[model samples]
Target: YLFSQRAAWKPALTLNGFLSASKRFVEKDLEVCVAGRTFMITGANSGIGKATAIAIAKRGGIVHMVCRNKDKAEEARADIVKETGNKEIYVHILDLSETKKVWEFAESFKRKYKSLNVLINNAGSIMSQRDVNTEGLEKSFATNVLGVYILTKSLIPLLEKSPDPRVITVSSGGMLVQKLRTGNLQSERGRYDGTMVFAQHKRQQVVMTEQLAKAHTNIHFSVMQPGWVDTPAVANAMPDFHRSMKDSLRTPEQGADTVVWLAISEAATTNPSGRFYQDRKMVSTHLPLAWTHSSALEEQKLMSLLEDLAKTFQPH
Candidate 1:
């Protein structure tokens, strides 16, 4: 696995990094109030996703919360409604690890919803063990990569219908250390390292977002690293790291700041699409002098592989 300690520097992913980066953010640029626009956010039950939902809801935007749990989604919806008093919050449940179910859900979503102004690919999974599903797909890859691809691909037609369509994916800084590896997309080779596997998936996401942005000019696509945040996912996935970095991690809201800005602020869209973002500014996908870059052929293979995998689950 391609690993670089310099790429995933501790201070860069800490709260101090956020504070430093946020100092330059144009506060006035994010005052947009989308009273009628609809936003779909996955894993909106809690953490950065939920924080983004709350921010949009407060601005009078209709929120479609895509969550994995019914009870948790409803609870989060209630909280958003109570806090924002917008009352347009809606919830849909589907496990991201279930590939066929994700495709079916996307189809059903198109039939039900008319407009989706923005689609936030926020939900991600990092499994400690290399668990394979019924389709023989690894759990983390299925949830983090294939599931996102299916949902986003299926809804492209609907997104194109919107006047201001944008797709923002929440990737990780951990991806900086890895390159897009189409040869072993399912983590079948070498020792099972969850962090590295997840990083590879995140790297794939960055490349995929870039490719999609180039393919669809009408729809803006962006990927971002939210820095280190204190959330349940982090706590569950890396308890030791979470404990050590407890005081240094950013809050869920702080982590969601850039996401909310990208969704609402016109300044964000003014920049080029398919670019990687940190805080509110566009940043390079690769680290300084890092050999994590992949060839055009590799990126193409990734999309093709995803398409082939998705075709098997297509509702014929």
Candidate 2:
């Protein structure tokens, strides 16, 4: 279970913890070095997304925040500006849960911004009950997996414009699950366990990322887990999870550190695509069972599903 309120989880990240983290990881000055680099971060109004946006902005990079709520995005941008004194941050409306809207937004974005240096697919949700979007897809799958698929596909041309394009998707440690239910992907025929279903989708994201890497040689694709960052999504999913893992969880700023590392670090340019990463370093992932876990099969199914969905909306 995760806690839904911020008040309940704020105290867990103390000054001592921040100091310990700075010692463990290389402290960077992003603004001086990261200027000119453009980044698109989803769910940029709060939690990990907000932290990542601020981190990129502070580093002197242009951060285009894609969030669902305009008001919340403005508030987040204001705060980042106040803290970092960087006014290059821009906000764009995008709701990943709504498949059609996401495509429309992505097309508009590409038109406005000719080239995107990095695309961070970080927005996600873990709903209490099963819910479907306007596209008639499961809410979790729509936002976490399918939305990412469409957005990445829509932005391919823009991404290709850059000298070296990178797609860094935020996956989860929970992706080490049993199998994917290709038959009942929406959980329409059976029960929906929040944790299990969310993990399955996250796993799908990792495998899909690998497949994309294989399919496209020019684009660099990598997936990362932020190590159980304290966020509202977790709190909303399971009410008790926050308190239980208070000491072990990382702060949003700390969590976004690796995201920045993957996006801008010179070391990442040489790293191979489709690798699973955590805490700013490469890591091993658990191999899944035969029928449910093949990268080729998952990629094929996802592409077919997304292509059909894309047909409904006219791309800009």
Candidate 3:
């Protein structure tokens, strides 16, 4: 089933094609009309998150830029304001690497915004060595997966208030080759493999979105791979590999286009919940045979773990 979807799907050409295909992609600069709608994008001070915030602001939307660094966020805010000429964008301090702070940030964010039209789970991490956070969880899992889970749960009520609520998680194509190892979820059992840990966490996101879509009918849930965007995250995470990858990589603005498209496009109205996307087109994320038939079972187990953790940590 998944393979057929992969076979039938073709990625949305280039942003260059979309740009040349219509004056609107140019006039609008590929930004969708988030005007009047509210968005909360994590890691919004840099990389693809910054671009996504700027894109939404360009279309006249209210953006809550969540970041860990206040000074960096202020710089990003200034750059965005200059680029978009839209002052609806604001910044919030959120170190998603910390679970307690994620919940607090969500509570404060909900109090300020009446409705949340979009939640872009754009923040992520890839550590060279296993680092445990204050919460005693693996840093990558805590920041990339658990943080997203808690933040989304806390904001679900706000999402319910919106006419068209969307949750777009930025996952990775690396998940295609990597399977989750339940025994080493925290990389505690053995030496840390940076890329593998990131892949596992991203796969966890896909599983979480799948469960969220199943439970929440009104809230649109989807995941997207930005296809090797030339961002600092990539540069810092894999300096050598990225040097070669950069030749084919998209700019941050180009990476931001599909995310903005998913948030506001008419196509989203009928799109299936929990679908995976690459570029602007929907794509299948099939588990490889090496993953064994137990892949589906593993996804279910991961969902159960996340739910249990959410209840234990955020038992409101």
Candidate 4:
């Protein structure tokens, strides 16, 4: 099944096959309105995150663009407002790598809004070299793993207040190559490869989704891999791969399709939670490989580690 689904990536088949698949999953003609719904999207200034924000805004959803750069975020917000004619767009600036900022943003958001319909953990980084944040955590692991964990943990109260609460995390197809490293999450013990570390973080996201879903059955927790998309982030982070696959890569709209669908589609909410999706369909989280599968003991250890890390970062 994985190999068959991967056929959409073949150069000769992508234009016809993948493009059409994207269109079908986009829910373009579906009249799903989220007029009163509120969404918070991290890293909304560019790439798939911006595209997801626009899709939600077009459906009359209140969008809060959580970004690190104020100017770029406001610019994107203006563009969304002009294009979608949805003036309910807002912006909050914070560097997710900063644990303190992540906690503060969550608290501030909860205080400002009565409810949060969706929380999109879309912000991510692919560092070429290992870098540590002020908190002395590896940059990619801090932003992609710890930061998301903290933000989601802090916002549980606000999400529970919503009529249909959902948490949609944007993971990556790269994670299929990696497995959870329960003890060495920060990659401190080995020679660091940025790509592998990034993939590890993505794998962590899928595990965290399952853990959260099990703990909070009332809130839907879904993580998805936006297939290789033609975005600025890709060009910057993986230039060689981008150069090779640029012609056949999916557009931002294609990448964000399932994200928007999961956010508002009744079909998605009704489906079982704690699943990983691609192109609007629930798919296997790991490929058939010896190292892909982790023991239940490892999963429990990961959950415990994440919970401890989140609590350590929580504001006093």
Q: Which candidate number would show the highest lDDT if scored against the true structure? A: 1
lDDT of 1: 0.92
The whole-model lDDT of each prediction reads 0.92, 0.78, 0.80, 0.86
Best prediction by TM-score: 1
Report the error of model 1 at residue 46, Å: 0.9
Model 1 spans with C-alpha error above 4 angstroms? 1-9
Model 3 lDDT at residue 264: 75
lDDT of 4 by residue, 255-300 (tens): 8878888898888987898899977888888665335788888988
lDDT of 2 at 295: 55
Clashing pairs in 1: none
lDDT of 2 at 243: 77
Worst 10 residues of 2 by lDDT: 1-10
lDDT of 3 by residue, 127-156 (tens): 999888887888899898889999998899
lDDT of 2 by residue, 67-155 (tens): 88899999999999998889999988878888888888887887787779899999988877898887688898889888898899889
Q: How many residue pairs clash in each candidate?
A: 0, 10, 0, 0
The residue-by-residue lDDT of candidate 1 on 155-260, one tens digit each, is: 9999999978999999999898897889889989899999999999999999999999988999989999999999999999999999998999999999999899
lDDT score at residue 243, model 3, on the 0-100 scale: 82
Would you list the clashing residue pairs of candidate 3?
none
